[model samples]
Every structure is written in C-alpha cells, then in structure tokens.
Target: MSALSPSAQRVQAVLDGFGLGHRVVEHEGSTRTSEEAAASVGCDVAQIAKSLIFRGKDSGRPILVIASGVNRVDEKAVGRLIGEKIERADPEFVRASTGYAIGGVPPVGHAVPPLVLIDADLMALPMLWAAAGTPNAVFRLTPEELSRLTGGRIEAVRKG
Candidate 1:
C-alpha cells in the first residue's frame, strides 16, 4: 500500500498514541462527503461519524460536534448545551482551530483542543467510519472506542 498522506499519518500517530488499534485507510476516491464516505467504506450513512466545528460566538472557542452522517445537528440546542450561541466555522477558522481542512476534520487530534460533543444516536451503532485528517482518508472503530477516544459528552445533538 502507498504511504498515508501527511495529514492521515498525523491521525494514525494520534490513534497509536492512544493505544487504539484502529487503522487509517486512504481511499482512491473522495470520502469528503457523508454519502461519499459511506460508499467508500461500504457502510450506511448513519455509521459515518461526521465531524463539524462551530465557533462559539462569545468565547471564540471551537466546538466540535461528532454527529452521525444521517442526522442534522440542531445548532440552537447545542448552543444551549454549551451555554453560548455558535456559528458555522469558516474554512480558515476550521483549519486554525483543528489543524485540518473542512471535509476532513477528525474527531480527535485537534491542534487546539475543542469542546466536543458526540451525537447520542451514534452510540447505538456497532461500528463507525470517520474522516482521518484528509478527504480521502478514513478509519473505523466501535462506538465504545469513539467514546474513549473523544471523551466528548454524548448528547442529543441531532435535529429532532
């Protein structure tokens, strides 16, 4: 296999550091979107862990929400949970905060530690596929492993 991209390697290193045995795989096609990642990984859309970053309007902090691909985040509800309103982070903010570009933000290994929240729906899945620091790179892990890796509060982040 070819070497993983530098960004992917960073994610792999973080996985290794955490003693998680998950393997990062780079696909020939794009895994940049939820549907694309699901097809690439041969998983249901709901099994894709989509990482979204929001900017806290008050603190200017980054808020990471790892939501299931099939779900839409209720931003207002999340803002309430975090005690502040949040706005969609722009590309520059995303890169500056997470050290990864949009469509490839991982649930872990952020340059600036973000307040994270995991979608409660994802906890029901047996396995999940997540972006691994690049648009074409991904990794799989059990819901339990995800919880361990992120330490993100599991909440009802999905739109009701």
Candidate 2:
C-alpha cells in the first residue's frame, strides 16, 4: 500500500543486479524476528532464513551467519571456521557494517560485505524467505540460490 522504504529499494537494486528482481514482496507490520516473519508469511519458522551478524574478535570485521529460523548459531563452530573468536554484533556495528538495523539486514547487499556462512539445515528446505531490507520486506529464493548470491559457505552452524 505504501511506498517501498529506502532499505528495500537498495535491496531491490542489488537483487536486480543479480538478476533476482522478481522476488521482492512488501508487507505490513514488522517482521523483525524470524518468528515474526514466519507468522507474517504463514509459514513454518524453519522456512525463514535469518541473517544474523557477528563480530569477529580476531579480524575486527563483521561476519554473517545466515541461519535457519528454527536454529541458533553455534559461535564456537563459526569461530573455528573463520580462525577467530566470535561475538554478537552490536546494533551500531550492525548498522554501520550492513547498512541495516539488526532486525532488517539481508543476506546480501551490505555496506561492508562480511564473510557469510549459511546454515546447512536451511538447505534442506526447498525454498526460503529472507529479509529484503526493511523489517516488513522479504524475498524468496532457493537455498542454493542464496549460497550463490552471497558466496557463502554452507556449514553446520546450528547449535548442537
């Protein structure tokens, strides 16, 4: 009903550049959390792809863990993969690095692109719903498509 937000527009441009221009969908209210997004789209939580940000203690850079909605990332495993200790990213750092708020960052199109690790569990689903920039905007893609788009490594990041 309303115009697309600036964040959504940026994401759209990025998606278009990647030839994934047909997937963006805008909805009302805040789909800030995976649970909220799943509820908004009337899908199982596992179908929501959550783009989580982490701070790399060793590299002093950002890291993104594209986790399944129903799973939590195991930082230890991720740190092992990246040769660094990992911590949850702060809101300021998240915004500065991703050009998005903590709840609205997409898997791609970041201000400071980070190393991405996708949850292997997400690959089990045929399709996934990911944040498209704003809290209420989303896009659909296959897990493989997500991997290719972000150049992310597929890993078992889900908590054990």
Candidate 3:
C-alpha cells in the first residue's frame, strides 16, 4: 500500500480528531461518481453518500447536502428548510468552501462549516461510503457516524 495523498490525509486527520476509527482508503482509479465509487468499494450505489455543495442565494453561505447516490436532491425543499434558495456551487466555490474539489468533497472537514443536511434515506443503510478528499480516496462509515461527524440534520432531501 502507498501513502495517502495530502487531501486524503487531511480527511484522515479530521476523522482522527473526531476519535473515529474509520480508515481512508485510497484507490488507483476514479471514485469521482457514485457509480464508480460503488464499483470501487463494492457496495450498493444507494449506500454511497455523495456530498453536494450548494450556494445560498440570499445568505451567500455554503450548504452541504449528503445524499444517497441514487437520490436526486430536491433543491426547493432544501431551500424551504434553510430559508433560502440555493444554486449549484461551481468548482471554485466548492473548493473554497470545502477545502476540496467537486468530486472529492467529504462529509466533514470543510474550510467553512456549511449548513449540513444528510438525506434521511441514507440513515436506513447499515453502512455507507463517502469521498475522502480525493477523487480516488474514500472511507467507510455508518450512517449514525455520518450524522455525528457533520452534525447534519436528517431530512427528506430526495426529489420525488
């Protein structure tokens, strides 16, 4: 096994800071998409926690939505819950907010803490996989741990 990339190391540090025993696993190929991540990690796509960043149109704050891989986020519902409409965050904004790029955003360790929301559907899964700060890195965790790590409210973030 080789060393973890700097980005992956940062995520590992955050996990350690939280006293979580999860390990960040680095892959040789892309885990950039939910399908790829599931193939690489050998898990159901629905068990992949895909982190999405949105920009609050009014507040100019970052919003983190960790949705199940198979679910599409209902932006309007999220807007209603947060009291502000949200727009898709660009790569620059995503990097600035999360200290990582679009495909590598993790559930924790953001440069600026966003209003974190975990999809309620994800909580039904016994185990989950999430990005670990690099397109090729990931971590395995429980849904309970995910909620604890991000202090994210569980919501019906999925679209109908």
Candidate 4:
C-alpha cells in the first residue's frame, strides 16, 4: 500500500472513526490558500471551508473556526460565543493542537477536541470542500454533513 501524508492519514482516521463515506482527491501541488485550493479542486472559492485555529482566552484550550472562503472570521463574535477572548493560533500552537501544519488543518481529528464553530455562509453552497488533513488533499460534502461529521456548531462565525 502507498503511504499517506500525515494530514491525509489523520483525516482518513477521523472519517473512519465516524463511519463517514468520503472520497479523497489529491492535487499535484500545494493548495495552501483558499484561491489556490479552489482552483486545484475545480470548485468555487466560496465553497472552500478554511479550518482556522485560535487560542482561547483561558490560554489553555484552542477553538477551531471553519469559515467559508469568501468570508472572514469575526474574532469578537467568536470570542463572545466562546465566552472568552480569542486570537489566531501561532504556527507552533496550531501544529501542537491539531497535529497538522497551518494550511493543512482538517475540520476533524485534532489531538484535542477544539470547540468547533462552522460558518453559516458555508450552508449556502450546495457542495463544500475542506482540507483532508493535507494541503493537497480535499473532500467534497454538504455543509450540514461536514458540520455533523466534525461535531461542529453551525453559527455566524464569519463576516463578509
């Protein structure tokens, strides 16, 4: 069998754990940005879900915000929802928390259970794609399914 990238492997493990049926697509080059990833996946940029990790106010746990490509996460709103201040997680903190690189963090399968919040805008898209534990790998699914698969709370996590 072929070896899988750490991110891909992690994503696969998560999917398997949840008994989700998904198809993984791998691209030839890096899809580090939403634009690049959308082009590689042949999908609209808005359909791409960006998995972002942020440090919680308590400084002990992390929050994972999955926002749509066309939207920006509202830090204040997220902070209020989580009942704590929030800041973007640094690269070291991100890797330590998710076990994946900055651009490759998946919506699921983190070393710890992050307080997951999904952007409501993503539900507008019929099909959405999220990083599959790797920058070059992605999987297609409905926003609702994605939310359920990740145990994410669907909310207004972003701003236009």
Model 2: residues >4 Å from true position, as ranges? none
lDDT of each: 0.96, 0.90, 0.96, 0.86
The per-prediction CA RMSD against the true structure, in angstroms, equals 0.6, 1.1, 0.5, 1.6
- Compose the digit string of candidate 3's lDDT tens values, residues 1-160: 7889999999999999988798999998999999999999999999999999999998889999999999999999999989999999999999999999989999999999999999999999999999999998999999999999999999999999
Model 1 Cα lDDT, one tens digit per residue, 24-117:
9999999999999999989999999999999999999999999999999999999999999999999999999999999999999999999999
Please give the ranking of all candidate structures by lDDT, highest first, separated by commas: 3, 1, 2, 4
Per-residue CA lDDT of model 2 for 94-126, tens digit only, reads 999999987889999999989999999999999
How far off is residue 72 in model 4, in Å?
0.8
Report how far residue 16 has shifted in candidate 1, in Å. 0.5
TM-scores for candidates 1 onward, in order: 0.99, 0.96, 0.99, 0.93
Worst 10-residue lDDT window, candidate 4? 1-10
lDDT of 3 at 11: 98
lDDT of 2: 0.90
Question: In candidate 4, what are the lDDT values of residues 1-160, reduced to their tens digit?
Answer: 4567766976887777777687666688877789999999888999999999999968669899999988889999999988999987899999899888888888888888899999999988899988887778888889988888878888898764
Name the lDDT value of residue 19 in candidate 4: 71
